[model samples]
Target chain A: MEPVSEVSGRAIPFGRKNIDTDIIIPAHWLKTISREGLGRGAFQALREDPANIFDQEEFKGAPILIAGDNFGCGSSREHAAWALLDMGIKAVIAPSFSDIFSGNAFKNGILTVVLPQEQVDRLLEVARTDPINIDLTTQTVTTPFQDRFAFEIDPFRKHCLLNGLDEVGLTLSRDEAIAGYETMQAAQMPWFAKGTGLAA
Target chain B: MASRPRTLYEKIWDAHVVEDRDDGTSILYIDRHLVHEVTSPQAFEALRLSGRKVRRPELTLAVPDHNLPTTPRLDSAGHRLPIADPESAQQLAALERNAPEFGIRYISATDAQQGIVHVVGPEQAFSLPGATIVCGDSHTACHGGIGALAFGIGTSEVEHVLATQTLLLKQSKTMEIVVDGDLTPGVTPKDLILHIIGVIGTAGGTGHVIEYRGKVFEEMSIEGRLTVCNMSIEGGARAGLIAPDEKTFAYLKGRPYAPKGSDWDEALAWWKTLHSDKGATFDKSVRINAADIQPTVTWGTSPEDVVPIGGVVPAPESFSDPSKQDAARASLDYMGLEPGQKLAEVEVQNIFIGSCTNSRIEDLRAAAAVLKGRKKANNVKWAIVVPGSGLVKRQAEEEGLDKIFIEAGLEWREPGCSACLGMNPDKVPAGERCVSTSNRNFVGRQGPGSRTHLVSPAMAAAAAVTGHLTDVRELME
Candidate 1:
């Protein structure tokens, strides 16, 4: 994971709600077993439509995506987050995200920006003309036309993403606490200390 | 100050509250954690990296399903397809490697009990009433059929549960969806849920925990309840639950995770009380007549764009909203179906009766009964049934259900999430239409440009026999 301080990129706005993980990366893509080349398959069906946002020239190489409410709603395919990352999408602005998808995005260094629907609509409009700017430190999304909106994130998730930390990182950060708990548990439940026996 | 009376949700929630934070969320102690090969790899890796042992090995279980091959075949190394999906294989291997390392019980691919985590969990009684079960799969809500508060978690959360046996969460508002009265004949639980999705639309239950109540749900078998709860995610719910009753206790009594001997009596007594009080209030309530439900099949890319069997596909002009009209037109065009055409007249190239949604033994039996002596349509390229678990497969085979399917020209294969999505080789070709027993009918869900009509197993079987989307009730007549 890497901290995304500030990012400037093209905007690909998908104006649909409940864009599930199955649509992002179809289950067929799961057969290969490797995360490599997933971006090519990302939005495969969407790309089939010549008028799709992903196929539009303006959105090509877009490192940021603006989506509608309840984005990434289906299967917990971490590949959805991975594919978005591989497609060079560093930030996603949406009204809300599925909890599992949001967690996957945060862990993979993808910044999921939660904005009000009005702000998202405004950003989608601004994205038509100029590159969008997302500042993690300021907690705001700014456009060249001088429009800006602040977004909210879970404080703990914000901390982790800002520090490029994952769950493993969070757990490691509490090494002393875990070690202390282990020692205390060993004393309180002696069976746990016996390495090879059942606890109860 | 007035003390608030606790609802069932509140009681179970309070019992599991291990820690409360300033942010107004609680860390809930998970009573049981079920894992599958697909999502457990990364969690195991995280545990290994941290050098932490599983807190309660006895409380955890694992199985492999999503990527297992429906047909038993040898890979280049002579290993099975369970070891085929390199990623899934790696995950399965990691689970096998880590389970013993962590002293957790894991059912490998070859194990007769190994299958979809949801299917295996209930069969093994790991998903008991009044328990807070967490799995790394969205359909973990399937366990909620027995009055358990089960929900899906991410890999990190999976590791959290494995290491600490607790989940950090904010409380969700409860929504009661009551379907009262007797379901009309031929209106199965699958149809009832599909109709619910149609009425409420996909995003209606967003951010809510839904509890299905009333006569219809109460009378449903444990399997039927599971089918309904399994699709909770499809309706945008965090999870779906039904209160525990005699049926629930009967289902768990002799299973692996149920309490033994004297403990069983105490467990049943506790489980019986795991229900809402008479005056329990909910944030929202919606009631629907069970008799109004009919055999439902999706007509468009989304599950909400569905109509009852024999109903006509809606035209764009039928929609008042311009945006909705455009979506409707596009979906109809994409599906290669004409607006106003009868749904039963639509041809189906394939018929799939599997996936977590409708792959249980009861589902198979329903389809088998319909296809018993009938031959499949000549134009139907494929009709397949993939059971949810090894146990289901074995049960079906023991009853010669496989022979019935094969005799009817339907393929009987091993248990896995086959054809539900275009995950494996069982996908319908691009531009083909299918009648599926799975949950979703999203664009290209079965394959690229493949239109899917979601239905019950019996409906799918009837469609396969007719080469079109026909009502299964008609076949019975």
Candidate 2:
């Protein structure tokens, strides 16, 4: 995964509400053995319509998206995040996100920028004709028209996103403490580990 | 230690925190990690790409349920399982290959222990009280009924747990719901939860972990408690739990994965103390009169679009909130329904009784009780009952529940998430309406353009018998 500092590009203005994981990447596409080439499956349901914005030429390869409230609302399938990433979407500006989808996005270097509904609506409007810019350093989303909206992110999530630190990297950062705890755990509750005693 | 009365959620959570990072999140160790076919392929592929082996294979369990064919092809004896859908076949094969390749325990489609991940976890005692369990399925909250700190996770988190049996998470706020008084004779946990979701709306429990308290849950059997917790996700809750009691311990007494002898005694002692203290505080609290609940049914697409069987569907225009009205109207359009229609008057073309939500022995018995000598209506073209697990199917067969269903004109299916999401062949046709005993009622969830009315198993059984959404109480007595 790559570090996510800033993303600037034309934004896809698909602000439909309650866009669930099933809609993001429907269950049928989840059968493949490999994760590659999932961008084709992303928004397959919406893209079926001839007038769908996802299939519109102007929004092709947009790096940012403006989505409605309760985005990524259903299922815990990480393929939803993977599909977004594969479609080259680096940032999703929404009113709110399903917690599972937000976590998956962060892990995959896709920035989930939560703003107030009014701000999100504004971005969706701006995204129709102009490009949008997001700066992780300043936690702000800007448009070509000079409209600027600031947002807040959890410091830990920001740290990981900026550093390109996955869970493996995070655990490795505190190896000594983890190792010490494992040792203590092994001694105190021998039966607790059960068959997982190979390593902590 | 200072004397502090802690909620059950707090006690389990506090004990698992390996480190409080002083940030918004904490690093907590996971005791058990369950995975399914759909979400884990990429995680395993990622591991292969990164050259990382599973750090604790024994702590992980894999099963095939979603996308599994309920009625597998049969030869002379046993399921030959010539899966019709290529994608569904591939997922099962992938799970079979990945589980063994990674050295994790795999229960395949043919395995007797195979079932929905949520059902198999507790039945096998793999999900224990006071343990933090995570699965890549949203219904993982089902385990919290046994007092485990369990919730759904994404595939990336699944991979993270595979690499290191731990999670870095910001603790969710605690919400408690207390339901008192006796339930109506025909009312069930499914009805109770549907009624609760109706009151709270879909996003009501967002950002919170809910603990179900009071006499209603206490008197309810473990299976009923599991049904309530299973649909917590429908309310947008991170997880739902009931405090472990004698019933909880009794259910786990001699299961294969549970501790034994002196270890069991020690585990029991600790689990006994897992209940909330006398006056534990919570971020949110709700109290409901259990007697007020009726056999509930979802009228629209979302789980929150629900009404009692006796009530009429409210007009979207009646709601003051603009968004609520818009959502309701859209749902009504998709469901081919109009406001002010009595719920019992809505006709159903299909009736399905299965899913992680309500496919236990009790659910089967309840539905069976309603349909023992009754035959389904002529207009109802299809009715199927898929058990949650192979063990459940076998037990039902032994008790003649399968005969009761078959005798009543409903097809008895093998264990799997058959028609719940239509990943398999057991789906209602497009534009058809179905009364289902599943957790979700998302539009086109059963099939493209197919309408679903969420109901309890008993209600669904009655619908199959009457060819429309009917109240079980009407048939009772």
Colliding residue pairs in candidate 1:
none
lDDT of 1 by residue, B1-477 (tens): 944765677768876665566666666667778877666776777677778878778778877777676777456786755444565566556677878888888788777787778888888777778778888788888888888888887666788888876666778888889998999878899999989888776777777788999999999999999999988878778688999999888887777666666566756766777888878898878999997888888998877787999799998899786656877887888899898899999888898989888888999999998999998999899888898888899999999999999999999887777788756557788898889998888888887878899999999999989999999999986
Measured by TM-score, the strongest candidate is 2
**Top of the candidates by lDDT:** 2
Give per-residue CA lDDT, model 2, range B1-477, as digits (tens). 867889999999887778889777888888889888888888898888889888778888899888887875465677475788888888888888999999998887888899999999999888889889999988999999999988999888888888877888999989998999999898999999999988876667878899999999999999999999998888778799999999999998877788777767877888898988988899999999998998999998888888889999889989897877888898898899989999899888999999999999999999999999999999999999999999999999999999999999999988888888888888888899999999878867887778999999999999999999999998876
Q: Which ten contiguous residues of candidate 1 chain B have the minimum total lDDT?
A: B80-89
Worst 10 residues of 2 chain B by lDDT: B72-81
Local accuracy of candidate 1 as per-residue lDDT tens digits, A1-200: 67767778788877666688888888766544344577888988878777878878878779999987778887767778878887888888998887668877887788899888888888888888778999888888898888988877777766767787655444444546555645653454232232222212
- RMSD to the hidden true structure, all candidates: 3.9, 2.1
For model 1, give the RMSD to the true fold: 3.9
Winning model by DockQ: 2
User: Measured with DockQ on alpha carbons, how good is candidate 1?
Assistant: 0.28
lDDT (0-100) at residue A164 of candidate 1? 77
> What is the Cα-based lDDT of residue B191 in candidate 2?
97
